[model samples]
Target: MRWWWQPRKQHGRIGRQVTALVVTTAVLLAGTWVGASRIPTRWFGPAHPASAQAALPVDRVVWAWAGAVTTTSATVVAEAVRPARRARLVLTADQAGVARSTAAVPVGGDGIVRLRATGLRPDTAYRYVVEVDAIADHARGDGRFRTMPSGPASFTVAVGSCARTGSSGAVFDAIRAVEPLLYVSAGDLHYGNPARDDVTVFGDLYRQTLTSPAQAALYRSVPVAYVWDDHDYGPNDADAAAPTRPAARAAYSAYVPHYPQPEPGGAVYQAFTIGRVRFVLTDNRSERTGTSLLGARQLAWLQRELVTAARGHAVVVWVNPDPWIAAPAGGADDWGGYPQERRVLADTIAAARIDNLVMISGDAHMVALDDGSHSGYSGAGYPGFPVLQAGALDRPGSVKGGPYSHGTFPGGGQFGTITITDSATSRVGVELTGRTWRSTILVSYRTTFPAPSTPPKPGTG
Candidate 1:
């Protein structure tokens, strides 16, 4: 999606309905718009096929995304063109056959599988291999992911949003190279949204984006958490009032692996804690209204979670799909449009003195780094936290004009990383880094938060 300001003229509208045909045409025709080289080499031909060494009885099993992670459990999602009654997920502490197996449940008729693995050790490293059938085929030869720590620990996370199916996806490689424990995709995983919101269209769109080599490799290795944006949700600028909201929500549920959703029969907006970090991912499109981005129930849930996380976790990561800082001119589709709600959130954080909040967002097709000062509140009213915007993973565009805070870098296949390092003492170091397609650091910011003092030892005096 383009920036809110200068929408029609300067940036051109985000394609209303981004079908495979439209995406191919746009990438081929506008070679100069985003840059011809940015398009994935495989898009000109069929989507990347499985490697020659892939196992038999399956053409290819595409690894989708991973999430619903806890101290002892996590889910892996995948899809295949070949039909299979059951899928196998094997987790091994090492390569020497100390393995645990889990069964996968098939969702819908599209051959999508969700393998929910449990009984995992907390704060441990494990190598995993996903096999479509017990004896037949395996999607990934071997992949590795670390379970979330049960207690205070150090970890890195990659965050980004808005990727079309055809982009070269260099950022995905960069993210994998960083070896983040988790990667949060704020929204817009794919661009194809038919006007009627057909399930077939949704499945096709997902395959086009998820099966690519870069994305598949990333998901195979790193766990992912997702939230939806406008295009992926339905249409351009679509909202909760859309006629096809139910269908869209169902399609998302069928394909994407996520934590238990808070809003039943609506979009997925949920919270999960991994070690010292508490993640609150918001549903921006489904419940959005003129006054609030998140509906009343969701908003209340968020406020309560913020307080709970602030009191306990070393850092609270608030994931919103739209840019929270350096808002554009007219606030139609972003947090800026709903000033009262934004004010309430900011006021609550400030009044509570929640010092360890870091907001990560995507949608603007640019990377923006802000200290929360530009959120339009002043005079100690809004004690702003840091908001990092990692935009347009592969879509065409650069950083546009706005009241960018300390660091704002032009975007083109870029993502953001947040590394939290906990210590024995009462201090936690948090680092935020933004990088480009070729792994160049665009902006890096670091801050330390003093952890709450330990309780006095009982009866010491």
Candidate 2:
């Protein structure tokens, strides 16, 4: 008599549907437990005041000639209730405010401050000051940086990623030692999950590195540009489906503001040209749609940018969070996950016949040089472009997924420096170094790109 006991023509179908629903619910619950349990206990805990005299860890410096912007971001740890508010960031060029400013307010529990100084002269050295606002209960420090020359610029820009904030000191020291004109933090700036100290290990590790003598000396002398990857964004192999994506986005927002970026979510992936080289920065995260990695809009934007760059005699550098050729099968974390988008990008570049298309990325914990030929992907069709995967400045020894385990660095941390010399004959050189070891062990091809035949007027585009 009851519905449960009633038999009908569709009774079997209804029973199967109900069974499927129950199974799905159970599976979802199990997944939730797995995800929740994975979250480290340290992340949700309280904060502690760091040392007032603590040092600041500097990472990458970026120089943009076309926009007339030389930007730098540093990771600083100070002993205070509020490190961000207490810290002061200032940049001075020839005793002028070429680019000098203070750290933002309400420094988080991590004590990491992203500092940026903008509006500077081309090919010029500028002094910077970081101070603590005693009245504001803040700690501070000082540093210096140099901007790239306008035309036919001869400058060095260091590139690296996968730094854990633990051994970042060596990388900073290396950069300072080189005294590069600017630095480009390709991606994976932080280990991600700033709240989870153990899993990400950014807060403590960054604190240690910031206090390092070698690292402090460098922050006092260089500028930096930054981007985020899965580790730095929130969780390993994270994406739009991440349940805590909002929190991750918030953290990213906080982290990015410390640097001199155009605008948050306003294409963190942007294009900047220095000398004859044009950099096409891509934001694989943020604005990502569905399971696709780069999303439709970003892919379209990238295609347009690539086309524009190809039209001129400029070296086109494509910066992504993950290596394109490393994970050809789509790891849901790299370009492989978005096969359609990646194909579209590769196809577009190939179609354009962009000769100087160089791929720069981070995420793999070791230094690697791939000819852009991952399994499953047709490298033959893509014209055999070169993809250089810079090792992490930190977390060098950690294992990475995919068939490329052999390339992983055995050491704990590492970084790569890219130097470009633009002249009648433009040349680009890459130097892979160990942060803790302090040695330039690995080197890449020194290739020449087409030199710019005409110079464009400089101004904010």
Candidate 3:
């Protein structure tokens, strides 16, 4: 609501800055600049001390994550603890030639703070800190994030989902070790009591997930792009009608550094780009109905995205949190239950003539991949495509959709890595691998997508 300039004093070399910076705060609202945007502001108050904020025991809330990142803009978010008037972001270049910044901005409320920066270089790493007033909050470890790469590039994105509430498994360390450009949490972020609707309850779950030593460290380093599934949204197999969905979404908007959604205060489905690959994350739970998967609004948006995908990007990653192909028997909770809409979606893809689409899904425990085979379910008999099923981050593995050409592994502590190489003269190749908690490869699949003949825009879409 309040948009006014607040002067900041520089603390490091300007040109060498990993990038520029912006910030905002929330007592539960988002503001301008994911150059850090909105963070949840759940203010818990005890009587104020006669002296100052330095001595207050504000340990109830802790943790920070940066996301909604771009070549020139990035957002950092942290939950509100006690009230504070101002907050700022401090960014340090990764190496000698990188850029660093100490852009300061006004904080709107006491408990939460968010800041975003613009004019940052693409694909550069920078360490960050969130300072309240002038003192640094220890919520962010030696945390760092890289802006999405610009132009033809090579990067690795780590993807996983399904962690028990407050799990701090070593798998997180494995994810951080890979140092992927970004981390994608496909769905089921936490298995808390979904029946609870209180915003604070969900907020507390986020706090626990973020503070767990290893997971916190991973998030501190890699920016995350996430969506929710059955367990995290409500009771297992919950649909759009779950009463607690609004509160769940509210917690998500407040806590996660995320992308722009198709609709405000609705499903968290969104799209973003890294190099030439476009990632389309879907909201399956909140929009689910007896006959629809993404709801009417999201389905239309998806059509437009696919229609334009082949013309612009080299690869399209459709992140449907549920299985895309044949769901297992008795699995009516997923696409299997909605045959008509599934046919329509498949038909749409066929009509678009897009062969660059690759699906990444979670919920089914095992990590599996099919190379453009067993992927077509359209009426025209659109024969083939690719699908990467990843997850069970810490849950028991169960196979749901497949007959995958690649073998599937059913076990706990699993994740997937997508290695993308987009070059100027050759085909853009994507390599998908299923791995374990200790980083062992379970199975692998490789596929090729048409690369732009001529150099395309740096960041498509």
lDDT of each: 0.69, 0.50, 0.73
322 Cα displacement, candidate 3 (Å)? 0.6
lDDT of 3: 0.73
Task: For candidate 2, write residues 87-145 as lDDT tens digits.
Answer: 54555578554654654555445544444444556766666544445342212254455
Poorly placed runs, candidate 2 (over 4 Å) = 1-68, 71-119, 130-140, 192-216, 247-267, 288-290, 330-332, 371-382, 396-410, 425-436, 456-461
Query: Model 1: residues >4 Å from true position, as ranges?
Result: 1-60, 104-108, 326-331, 376-380, 398-402, 453-461
lDDT of 1 by residue, 1-461 (tens): 11111111122222121221224454456553443333332233211111212222334465456777777887777775566666667788854558778865554357787778888877677776667656523454356677788666788999988777533365777888899999999988866554565777777777767666677777778888898888888888778886657777887787887888875557689888776677889999888876678889888888988987787767788998887753434556776677667777877787778888888888877677776666544336656777787866766544533455655654446789999998646878888887766677777788887764542111101
Candidate 1 accuracy as lDDT: 0.69
Total colliding residue pairs, candidate 3:
26
The model with the greatest lDDT is 3
lDDT of 2: 0.50
Residue 424 of candidate 1: its Cα lDDT?
Answer: 46
